[model samples]
Target: MATTTERVKESLLGVEEDLNMSQPNRSSFMQHAIKDEQTGEEYLNEQGFINAIAPEGEDYHKIKRDQYSILFNVADRNHKGRVTLPDWSVFNNLLAKPDAEYEIAFRLFADPTTGQVDFNTFKEIYARNKTSDTIPFNWDSDWASLYLGGKKHRHSMTYPQFAQMLRGLQGERVRQAFLHFDRNGDGYIDPDDFQRIIQETASHKLSDHLLTNLPTLCNITPGSKISYANVRAFQNVIREMDLVEMILKNAINKSSDGKITRVDFLNEAARVTRFSLFTPMEADILFHFASLDQPSGRLGIADFARVLDASWHSTAGLVDQGVSGPSEKPVVSSKTFLHDILVSVHHFALGSIAGAFGAFMVYPIDLVKTRMQNQRSARVGQLLYKNSWDCATKVVRNEGVRGLYSGVLPQLVGVAPEKAIKLTVNDLVRGKFTDPKTGNIALSAELLAGGAAGGCQVVFTNPLEIVKIRLQVQGEALKAAAREGEQVTKRSALWIVRHLGLVGLYKGAS
Candidate 1:
């Protein structure tokens, strides 16, 4: 027996299926151009914006409408109680830079009076951020000829024209992609073939919903191909995905479960979102069709992202990520084992150098302490040194400054292995327990990592300490050496290790 999904697939085709996809729970998408009371000119409000991108059939694939409830809030960003063309332009960084970054940069490179920059200044602008190793910008290059009106030095550009030039570069590439699919140069690309261009350029950045439904809107019959003009409009919407996502994210509180019911999303988005790109109906329809996973309404950022963005998924899974805690993390990391090992090794190397340096600085003090504890004197008056300072000074005077650092070799050597092993063990273990999504570890996992590191440190540190003690005690004070013909043979680190043997070195390890 065929399943209902299989029967639906068999029965529905093209326009019929697309129409059925339109949600009946909300008002049908009706385009009503808003008139600004002061200007007496009708401007496209949020409804018009959604219509431009979504078209007639399969409106659920588009954004939902706030059903006139959220319109005033969405359109009021321009202060004219509407979303002006300039507001859209600034949000997209089209026509002009919002922060005046490129404008200020232009002024610096251009003549203030003429408001124009010559070919030299233009190349200088390009070169300002380039490294010496980067290929130099050539005025005669093919890209420069196309973008800068040939190689002529006579071609000077102002900030307004420069902004368009920068903007057109991306559009030109999209056009080229569209043209590639338009094999006959008929100015139309097949819906299926045109999708290839979007897949190539935008798949990684665009949401799955937009990519699937956007091409279906381009059916103009004859051959059911999408026009270049329609493709251009679609391209424009793709550029605004970032701004739309930013606005949508702003509407929801991340600290919550991150799920907003359909009405709540529309109303909340009304409060937070700028510009009138989505109507209440449009948003409601999207919430119905687009949200992916939910027992409490599937309207998480990921599902909303199916309508909104592909850039930053979300904070918590439902909002951006999870409800109460991190839930989106994969059990295994994407990083290769070799990569994790290399990263651990890098940190361990840095830690070892730091430990060795610190140990070297304080080794002399350790030498004095070792000597003070080891000294044998029957009477209090026959004591070689009274305190830490006296022992340090007496050793320097007797042993010609080198005696105070008698066992520094083993101390420094010991520190390197101790730090290296401890850090490597901790890092490897932490990497195992860390949440791949957030890179955070649980409190229990952190404690385990630290304990593992400490356990590993004993392997190298114990033998090193044994060798260190041997060297420190070998060096004698001047008064101790004053006994005639009483020779105290000094052993090097290698000699001590050789005599102690592998088993003997760890004798007093505990």
Candidate 2:
């Protein structure tokens, strides 16, 4: 007797032949039969693909494994046991472009001829290359001759290979910088060289706190340079130095001789000391906007003070005008004011609830969108994902239908406060303006409210937004960077506060 799969295949074949002979154009019967056959085939294919990539000793497909729960669910399209060639093609096409590496396997398994990728082909290509030590060909040969200098070699690399390349380069660079910084040549950096070169450098002039923290910044020994493994630990230091140079460059460029003076340096130093962080360009923009003497190209302490005073006064005036106009001023009586306050509170609460509801609704899609955005470019047969539907289907297949909601909680938590504050403030502001003739309020109050609400929201939500965006964008690489001491890991809000402070958030505020 034939196996269960063979029986099903014979059954499907019989249906196809019957339909072709009796009803070649039988719309209803043909459609139903085709759909059923396609569905079964899809299911079988999906299972085969999963089994192909599944790790050994696991009864279920590897795609059903823990870490890949999200990825597997996303790739399984058509609720079929398999993802068809058309489905795989959609994934492969996108993977071939920029910023989409997750779909690497689709590209690799894609049958360039019939435009279909079967399980055996996917398995053979994937498993064969995976055991490269036994292969005859060198996997590291350069294959970019078609684009560059006809220097063809076998140029294909896995994630590990690419990572090794970057690590190797970083190691080499760190060795060079370490050697370059080791001035005294006593086999290590001496105290005198450290003070003269590192401490005295313009880049190291950041306040005492940062200077004190410098020793903790890297994992290197006091006298020795950093190792190759610890090279990423200097990223923050390099980033800080870049920012400092950017500020100084702008200041020097302002001078007629294109040179910085002591006073110019002192002024910038004082500003940085006060703010704890500064983006010089943002400061210049703020000054330009607030300058009363438009063409002066210079601002004094008075101009700065006036700008703050004006902002405060204008904000207050807008609020006052919103609450009390010619119509009635809402009777300003204590009882009336209390009633108005209660009403405003209700409005705010209602607005918040609605905002929260809306946020939770779109969160899963947002997660998928974010993942798609974070995807990196990759070659065929090696990608982790295919396309949006593939990603979603794979998630369902691997993670029991809930994998798509992985980061939903954090996203909902981040967006609700920002949205609620914006909406409530806008309603309150619009409530202030009363029409004189028709007792109707204009939309102007809403605009002012939006501005104020937006400012407040930025202060509160920016840190969360920063962390969320970074988490979404960089994935595990950023987290690893933090662990290696390359970045100062802190909560999004506190990190922003410590590094940027109040003025840092409002970097370009006038």
Candidate 3:
């Protein structure tokens, strides 16, 4: 019998096969795995796990989450919440070299007190190793100072120190952003410098008030100059506004063309902000401002900055003397709400209309195809019609033009609902599969939606399709009955349904 460690390794190898991951990738994934505190079972959290194995496209995050869960479950040897060191050691030995580097990494992740590792510790170690070939194990190293430092100089970080470290990271990011805008090696940012930076980095322009009041807003006494100290004081506000602008630009510039069209702005804004912090109305208003004074409806970086500036000040209730005054309230238009509703309904409406129109136009050809398919003569020469044209000609000549349209009314009625259901259900199913965090749908979700829609539409379409096929084949049957001198009765859709039961309507549903 296999040992517990061996069983865990086997399970992990099976998961590796299931994920189609190479040995190196598998090792990397396992390195980030952490044991749950309550259950002692190994598992990877969804966010970090996704970055390791996620594929491209909307459903990538979900696929990563599922694969990670499977692998974690496999490595949890005792079916506990956490995977103990013995189980992980077995898995690591199978895929990775048991070198000094590996030993150091393991120690950094394992808790000194409990001798167990969790995802958070694993993630820290993994990130450190990824950035540098050598592990920074020295207590006095910059890495250690950045992440582990506290008043007492403990080996592990306390909660307050961790929070302080995160704030430091954010501050570093803001400082870097501020440096990017402070051109010409200047310690201060003037109106021109701000404008130039906004033009370069964003797709909108800074509002007049935001530009004029920047010095005052940053707590500069002169109201004309912005110093580094002032920027540091207002870094959080600047970072938040910059993040919003970045989100907008990324969402709009789908083609990477350095500009956004009005249509692109609207569509991408809806998608990016669907589950983001920004409300739909706010997104719409930003798009509106970005499109202002631009008849071409294409906005560049300056336009994006202007929109961001307007939105930020409006939220803060700041008045621009030259622009919208303090007395004027920010306008919240209902147009975006209507536009969202319209977008939701557009696909269903288009499908219904197209289905109705296409059915009406190609119905005669469908009649020919059905009639040709239904003919069951073993000998080719005994076939009802030589070809499609011949079949169509004979039907037109023998039954008149109206005969070809015998079942068209029911078909027309069914086509609209069938098409509508197919398209609507597909969208709905896709929405169900969307990741709540990122608002992305997976390819599997799309395929499943399409299959579900096709199956659902068949319920409404089977009866009409059956009726049409029967009517198309009726002309041949009538001729045969006449030639045999037998009394023949015409069968309508209702008559067939009554005789064969409702199941007859779904003759070829399978």
Candidate 4:
């Protein structure tokens, strides 16, 4: 019956284990600023802070100076030339309110003159939040007590506690994700279903290959159900992905060669991130997965980048540049013969593959339909083939299972041109008839496209249909002749072609 706020507050306050918002999840500028400080501890002295934030080169003049000074002043309330850890932590603490409004509460409830949050200030913030529409019921004084306790000294909250609350909220989101995929009310999710969960929830953390095969990692056996513990471990990867990318980028930039050793990666990952990001075992597996084919077994930025996606790859070409160019463009057609040939070949191959696959899959069924339609009543040489199944059974009994696939060669031969011309003609006609603005065609245009496609396909399909039909019924003809005491002659495809000649094939054409 506990609400989200209550759960998060409890987890942050209590010894709850699941909260995990890694350092990389912070904004890029903040991460860079924190990195620049280089203090072994969380906060730096005022001079060290200023030195870290401001630039030192030719470009470090009024514009850049003014920007960094404004940021420094926000943390240094009361115009104190010295900024302490509390001042810095409380200022950066604004970022900790990912779900709930600790920022608003901090601003409203902190002492206006003294600017410190005590138990009294905390209670007042709770009272105000209680009247409002946010911060659901059951979130209470317990979190404040535990956080303000310990070496943090029960005076006021610091950045670590605030971050803890944020991580706790993230943990709840992870649990909700688990429940979402566990649709059968079972304790665990199937491997196939686990793939959906990992992709939907943590796709930003991994490569496409890892995203697809993550269920394999979660499952004990192939196609088995996934446990919540495994799901948690899988979800944990993304929390460190951003950190991984930054460390890798830094390492590669520092190196002469573009490669990084596994030891360097592990050291950097641990140094930069808050969590036990990559256990020794995990580091070994990650290195194994991302290893190159070389004897050194080292990883280049390019190789590792392939296996790590922090959601930063962009297809937007280059940034807009030199914006003073002319707006007008030439209207002449720019395509060459080589371009035309390549496009034509591409379309031809597409059509051929589609047509061949279709014919190959269903040719047996088409053969049966052909045999049924071509059946004729003869006093001396007739076979009483009733329905489709009866016809199929008879054909198989007389000629074997291969009989069901009779005449497939000519069918495939006919289909290539049939689909190719249909696809090309339909696209052309539909494009011409489509509305210029909306790119949609009217019903009349659609009908016209369909008619053109059908008309063009008939040119290729009719001749082949005749050939396939003769082949499909050839077995029945021989069997009937044998029963009727006549010569049982077997007809070949080349014989049928010669008998029909070029013109004879189109005997019943429109």
Highest lDDT scorer: 4
Candidate 1, lDDT over the whole model: 0.59
Ranking by TM-score: 3, 1, 4, 2
lDDT of 1 by residue, 1-510 (tens): 976554432222101222222222112222334667887755556655444323434323222333222323322333354444333322222212243435434544555445566777777756764457432234565665665676554477756676666666556656766766677888987777667766655665565666766556443234577788666666665675565456556655642766566566556656665655655534433554354343345355655655654332322212111111111122123478798778888988898898999888888888888888988664666976788898888788878688878888778888987888888898889978986433457999999999989888886788889988888877673346555456666668999889999898888766
Off by over 4 Å in 1: 1-332, 378-382, 477-484
Q: What TM-score does candidate 2 reach? A: 0.28
Sort by lDDT, top down from the best: 4, 1, 3, 2
Worst 10 residues of 2 by lDDT: 310-319
Between prediction 2 and prediction 4, the one with superior TM-score is 4
Query: Which of the two, 2 or 3, has more TM-score?
Result: 3
lDDT digits (tens) for residues 1-510 of candidate 2: 877555433322111221122121122112322234543532224333333233235422211243332333334443434444343333323323343332334334444333334434644664654434321222222322221123343233333343334334333433444456555654454333333233333222232333333343222244344332332333323334444454555565666755444357447655655564533433432343234343355543333332222111111221112211111122233336778778867766776677678877876676667767665434455654678787566556755456555545555676777777776676666656644222345567656777888877777667555555444444334434555678744344345346665655555444
Model 3, span 132-204: residue lDDT tens: 4322223344544557543356355433344445446545544555566566777877755444333333312
Candidates 2 and 3, the one with greater lDDT: 3
Residue 241 CA error for candidate 4 (Å)? 28
Mind giving the per-residue lDDT tens digits that candidate 4 earns over 1-510?
887555433333222333232342222123333322555434444544555444244233213343344345445544555444444444444334352244333443444443445545665555653435322322333443455564335566433455455456444545665676677867687777667655544554356656655556533334467777666655555566666678888877777877888788877887777765776645554554455323265667656754574233321211121101111111122356686567667777799889989998998888888778878666547557768899888888989998788788988898877888788778768866875433457999999999998998887788788888898888878877888899967887888889999888887778
The TM-score between candidate 3 and the true structure equals 0.39
lDDT for model 2, please: 0.43
Clashes counted in candidate 1 amount to 24
- TM agreement with the true structure for every prediction: 0.39, 0.28, 0.39, 0.35
Q: In terms of lDDT, which candidate is stronger, 3 or 4?
A: 4
